[model samples]
Target: MLPLIDGKVVDITGPGRTDRFGVTCTDLGASIIAPNGKLVSVFGDTFSGRRVGQGDWRSPVVLIGMGDANHEIVYEYAGGSDPAYARQLWDYIHDDAASGWRRGGISTVIPSDLLRVGGSLYLHAIVNHGFGDVIWTEIWRSDDSGVSWTHLGEQAKFPADLHDGFAQCWSWDFDPDDGWVYVVATGFQRDKGIILMRVRPDQIGQRSQYSSWGFTDGRWQWGQQATPITPPDEHWGELTLRRTAPGKWVLGGFLASSYALGYRVVSSPVANMYTTPVQTPIVGSSGSQVAQLYGGYLLPGSRFGVTGGVGVVVSQWRTDTGWPYRAMQFKAKLKDTSKTPRTPDPVNL
Candidate 1:
């Protein structure tokens, strides 16, 4: 198995576009590579101009741009009425009347992660009951890239108590090799361990079709009750488990306990993450370049094997002053320590 030995930060993405995008005070950039070869990104809790009346402060908006917009996050306003601003996914979900928080009634239905399956884009979003409390999660889809969406509805909605709430937040990828969508999920608010699950791409809307990996009877079982892939060593926040290509995987996210973005080069979902070490390439700090870091979404150009490196999109929010709350891109240099190459599992998740 190819394990990441070490890594380094490459650069911040979008240049001045963080300011140019007009949506300041945003966090959690969950993205996917669209069929048109564009990097379609979604952000949570956005603020543009005002906070009420559908003018500004939109929760969960979409931004379409080139994956390699290292120079500037050039945008295409194909999803919004305004030809100049990024597209806000939901207009009905506006700021509350009193505190003006929770862009959708008492809570913001925020985007957790995004994935492209077949010709459509699917997004996993959390419905909140309060701070650190999730009521449920639903998957939404869009056929015309990020322009619009249709929710999978009540039948497909995942309850917050599902798997003891570990299924509240998710990051997933489609594996064409076996036609299964491998999912790695955790609780919101960074309070739980990671769990691995798999569902067919077509059956993603059906909760009964999902199967989880757990260590039971002294061996790994694909259809067993869900178990944390990582021991309760630390609290994990907003995770990203992506297959850069088939059979190639890298998993990481906000390590809430350490206040840093950490990752592991996982060979597979069932490849024993309990013992594998996590590498922290970017550390969060108050005086350093990155502060209050979270949301480690792997961009399109990220590589998995040798010549390893990941261009990840990370979010920074200054708790003291929320002005610097935005998403930036950083490349992590990877070190491989594999003595011999590994092959894909003939039988799958």
Candidate 2:
């Protein structure tokens, strides 16, 4: 991984309409180490340096992955002119004569997290736009450090029939401890709400079928069955996991709703699969990236949590009493996750 100077703001322009898929900072004040033992740093590009939601143009989707300590992988998904963007990425990571890598579908594979397991590097991508409109969680692997790819296929069950809409899955992570991968997704069969599912690494590149929904509404509560954490209904995007203390893993992200947008936290038994999620106050939005610190640890002496990506704060519009918290600039006091309470106590003290 490249060592970016602390507090250094670099500009990378000229990538026609860039859509940043995710951002991750490695060094979390010594909690999580960078990919290769070096301190982790920030590496993300905006559309011509414009803020995330300000520009009218759609940016290129970028996903960051770690492959060993020396190399940081940045994967982009562009379904325009190139047509073979995914294939190009495959070629870049693998050698020739390779029959297409293992992937679920072909439209858009925007990876949420890139992980290395048992000498092979696997990518967790949210299949946004494909031949079918449905969205899905897809996995792609490279045994030789971004050399040749073996499209392991969709990380979830392959439907009997393909749908048109994107298979909008929230986010996913891998658990080395249990050897399983967990994902949170919404079934298009329904209008709204989310359904979470758990899969294994061996299930990659292969297809499975599910008769009914994978999760229930009460499943996201804290200290209940299925990992025992209650996730907020706010627009909580994808999830990323890391080991903070011994045998303890924390899930981080922003809970985005029509009323409020802020960071969230939950502890889990397995590494990436989140069964139950308890909401915390690390409130704020991180655009495409959630509340994950790249190195996979919280900040040193930092009571509050650290949020990545285009940090934007919106007021809570929907509450029990219908009180609205207007969107505001959170640049100054954003990192104060320590001050946040376990429940929805947005007193702003």
Number of clashes in every candidate structure?
Answer: 0, 57
lDDT of 1 by residue, 59-163 (tens): 677878765412224555434554456556755554344655645554677888888888899989887755677778889888887778888777679989888
In model 2, the Cα lDDT at residue 26 comes to 9
lDDT of 2: 0.32
TM, every model: 0.84, 0.45
Cα lDDT tens digits, model 2, 1-349, are 3232112111111233122421111011111122333221111111222233223222122222322212222233322234223123432221112334334334333344445445665554444443324445555665644434466644343442322221343344556766665554433322333334555666555544311222245323322222212333433433334333334444443333432232333344322222233344333333422222121212211222433322222222222322221111122122332223345422221
RMSD of each predicted structure = 5.2, 12.2
Query: Any runs in candidate 1 off by more than 4 Å, and if so which?
Result: 1-22, 50-55, 69-73, 78-83, 94-105, 283-289, 304-308, 337-349
lDDT values for all models? 0.70, 0.32
